[model samples]
Target: MGILTSPIPIQAIKTLCTNCGVRDLCLSIGLSNEDVERLASIVTQRVKIRKGAPLYHAGEPLRSLYAIRYGFFKTTITSEDGREQITGFQMAGEILGIDAISENRHACNALALEDSEVCPIHFPQLERLSHELPSLQSNFNKLLSREIVRDHEMLLLMGNLNADERFAAFLLNLSHRMLSRGYSPHAFVLRMSREDIGSYLGLRLETICRAIARLREMNIVRISGRAVEILNLDALRGLVAGCNRHRQS
Candidate 1:
């Protein structure tokens, strides 16, 4: 049970997107200046979700696509036996709710890992605007494709990588994304907990803790609770490459 707060004004959301620091990484990336202004009109409102709150839940009718303006989220699916699998973690500038485009209903739950703000793009208007703006349409397709590729990578991690390799790759991927957002590549706070990391990586919580400890012992990374510092990025990359070689052989 998560709380949904009142939405910020539509005008506010538009202004935020227009001046957003990471607009290049968001849906507005390639739009012409005029089209970017047009986009401001289509983005409906800024919805605020408190920590531990769900932005949307499984089976909910899909009415909008949300772009994270600030904070983090984890999207998850629950099994028939009640096990929850984390499908993805989202940060600022990433799109959410795309999975529902086909079914018209959300297939998973998106929970805010921290207090967050998101700009909700009304789906109907977005579709209509896409028809008018070729760049917007192309970007939408790329976003969908990127999600598919991310899913494939997750499958690869689960199928081919050992626990240590999996963890290292996860950290590397996070670093890459953070770097793209202009954040420090070697150090950042882990927004999600060990259990959440374990769920996403298909490992037990104890196993995740052990892997983190092992990385620290190897001088590859230093983890103090939720803070992580990559001490030897090359070593982490080597570990990942070694795992890939094992998979290929």
Candidate 2:
């Protein structure tokens, strides 16, 4: 695997550095002594990306694997028609760019939606580290598996989900993901723009706006520009669950 430059903070990547969002996830999962050292050696702080910054573009040579440190990123690929297909969103503690592991180039472009930081871990050194650390080998396997599943779900959503269905599902999934990361699932700002959300959900930008307004009318959510609050989470869940029945109808 070719290594690319990273944008994580140097301080946060230092071993014994307790500031990394993925520390608990990375450390607690499994790692060997040698693996830890090799991993640490290649770990470099990434350049901080402001909102709308390009972390890397499609067709760029893959140099390193990346882990999001803070904020959100939207990954997309351009089609033959030059249309953009939103592939996925990356959050803090989540790994991005699995395709580069084998492909040697970024298949999709990773873009920051807010001021964001990424940590680049050199892959060749990481391969050696994983060989020495059995737990790390297992950890790598699990991460790739999850990436496959996520891609499958994205494909399904893009092909089959309708406008309202897409909105409800996105809100439900986003809330659950944030809650897993110890963030306030209900009272969080949407760092991604409506257009990006539309791209991912395969809906029109106006449809995304209208859906958010409808949620507010139902008293299920409160939206003020990018800041969104799930005012009644139970009601929101009900709306999402209602999608299956609505689809059946």
Candidate 3:
């Protein structure tokens, strides 16, 4: 059984929103100390999910929004033909379950790509608290707006970019996000499989491999298995410049 499939003991939880390492990247971004305390009160506990275990499945009733305290996850939607379409990947400090807020049920499945811990913030209590904390409300709105912008960008990537350009844009985007979170942008390990990357980029597995090989040949990035070291960030950025300009225009 998965770590989170059964009841999690209270002792298993080691953090809360107030003392969380990634609070600045999460909902605690604009809140005061006192306000953070109020937010922390609603986050009763953290849950550990084993790698490959799901935090929640599509159509499950959404009860809480999970803030990733550590590790990574991928949210996906399955098609009628039984194919999984990767929607997005979530890393430490990111929030999940926002998709459920609109329908009161999850629209996609959130699976931990690695062993992960997440703080569960009760949604009803969060709504009540947000009303009392204007800064919290504003932050929540910004999170929603960020999601919308991300979705828009994905659409642009899928529609306008070719296979190699899509891969380049994907790397640049991940690099930017990782840098913002204080990680080395030029080198990082990919937790997800190449197949997963192919699904997210809307390309076939062979296509993804070809794209990677092409990038490697050009010395834009050096990929040794899952470890990726960006060798020419500017070249990678240049590959996607046309698509980016199109989006801007």
Compared with the true structure, all predictions reach lDDT values of 0.88, 0.74, 0.87
Evaluate model 3: give its lDDT.
0.87
Residue-level lDDT tens digits of model 3 in 162-203: 888888998998899899889999999999999999999999
Error of 1 at 38 (Å): 1.1
Give per-residue CA lDDT, model 2, range 117-177, as digits (tens): 7777778877887777777788888888888888787776667666666687788888998
Ranking by lDDT: 1, 3, 2
Report clashes for each candidate as comma-separated counts.
0, 12, 0
lDDT of 1 by residue, 139-170 (tens): 98899999999989999999978888999999
> In what order do the candidates fall by TM-score, top score first?
1, 3, 2
Weakest 10 consecutive residues of candidate 2 by summed lDDT: 240-249
Give the better candidate number (2 or 3) by TM-score. 3
TM-score per prediction, in order, is 0.94, 0.85, 0.92
Which residue runs does candidate 1 get wrong by more than 4 Å? 1-12, 243-249
| Better model by lDDT: candidate 1 vs candidate 3 | 1
Which candidate number would show the highest lDDT if scored against the true structure? 1
